[model samples]
Target: MRNLKYYFAIFSIFIMISCGENAEKKVEEKSKEETQIETEAKVSEKNVILFFGNSLTAGMGLEASEAFPVLIQNRLDSLNYNYEVVNAGLSGETTASGKNRINWVLNQDVDVFVLELGANDGLRGIPIAETRKNLQDIISTVKEKNPNTKIVLAGMQIPPNMGEEYTTDFRNIFPELAEENNVELIPFLLEGVAGDPELNQQDGIHPTAEGYEIVADNVWSVLEDVVEKE
Candidate 1:
């Protein structure tokens, strides 16, 4: 009877020890999971800046790094701003196509949206009203997706090959949209680089890598205000 009692006591202690170890291990695992979750949350907390446009924004004929959007990203990183820039530019994309893809591009949250379309539309001589409506729909879709997303319209200008009246109407589109939507505007996206032989690539449309530096500056001027305010 004494031996049996001693064995029973020993067995109880072994079970208690096993349960204590299991409990401790579970607690440690839970702590690790919580830490991992917090780390992921921190990573996801970074804001996003989406640049939606055409070949210019896509940096056609230049490396992805030479694109103004990437340059903007590098500048943001240098300033230690926690924003991720998504270069959603597609070569040859017009405002109509942009409107079609805006919803898909906006799958993730966007803090700042830079609209750089309609240049192709102007170049192609698409009707001013159609371009305007497409852009308005795009803007409306963006606002509907997230009302707080700040938008910046990158104004563009084309030569008079499409007629001076058409040119004037296209030029007027950007500021009008900006005023109507109450969004920020970059007066002219190509500013210093446009029509400058040295600044352009062979196509005379897209900027050279060197010219992209100026383009980045043009964007940053207005972008700085928008981001700093945030």
Candidate 2:
């Protein structure tokens, strides 16, 4: 009877030890799961900067890495800014197409929206009023989707092939919209790079890799202020 009692006591201790270990293991698992959830939330919390535009934004005739938007991303990362850049640039996107597609792109939360459309419209000699309306509509949609979204318009100018009157009106559209909508404006997206053969690709429109560096600078000038404010 004494031997049986001693064995029973030992069995109880063993069961207790096993249960304690199991409880500790479950606690450790829960801690790990909580840590994973927090890490995922941090990643998802990163702000998004969407570049919406045409081939210039798309880096036409150049590698995607060579595009100005990616260069901007590199700069942001180097500066330790926690922003993700979404290059929504389609090669042939005009203001009308951009207006049509703005809703789809707005499905994701956008912290900063850099508008780069209307260049194609300018080049195509699309009616200035029509381009202006399309651009305004796009801006309106963005504002409606999220009033908190900071907008930045990339001003562009085309050759006089479209006629000086039309070209001037097209150029005026950007600032007018910027003032009216109270959004940031990149005075000239290709400032130093435009009209320079050395900076242009063989097609004489898109920027070369080296040219894109300057273009990135132009964007960064305005974008830096907006980002810092944010």
Q: Root-mean-square deviation of each candidate, in angstroms?
A: 11.3, 11.5
lDDT of 1 at 126: 99
Q: Candidate 1, clashing residue pairs?
A: none
**Model 2 worst lDDT window (10 residues):** 1-10
TM per model?
0.85, 0.87
Candidate 1: what lDDT?
A: 0.90
Tens digits of per-residue lDDT, candidate 2, 20-88, equal: 665777656655655565566555556889999999999999999999999999999899888999999
Q: Backbone clashes in each candidate structure, one number apiece?
A: 0, 0
Q: Cα lDDT for residue 22, model 2?
A: 55
- How far out, in Å, is residue 193 in model 2? 1.0
Report the lDDT tens digits of candidate 1 across residue range 1-230. Answer: 21343454455555655666657776566556555655655554668899999999999999999999999999998998878899999999999999888989998889999999999999899999999999999999999999999999999999899989999999999999999999999999999999999999998999999999999999999999888522
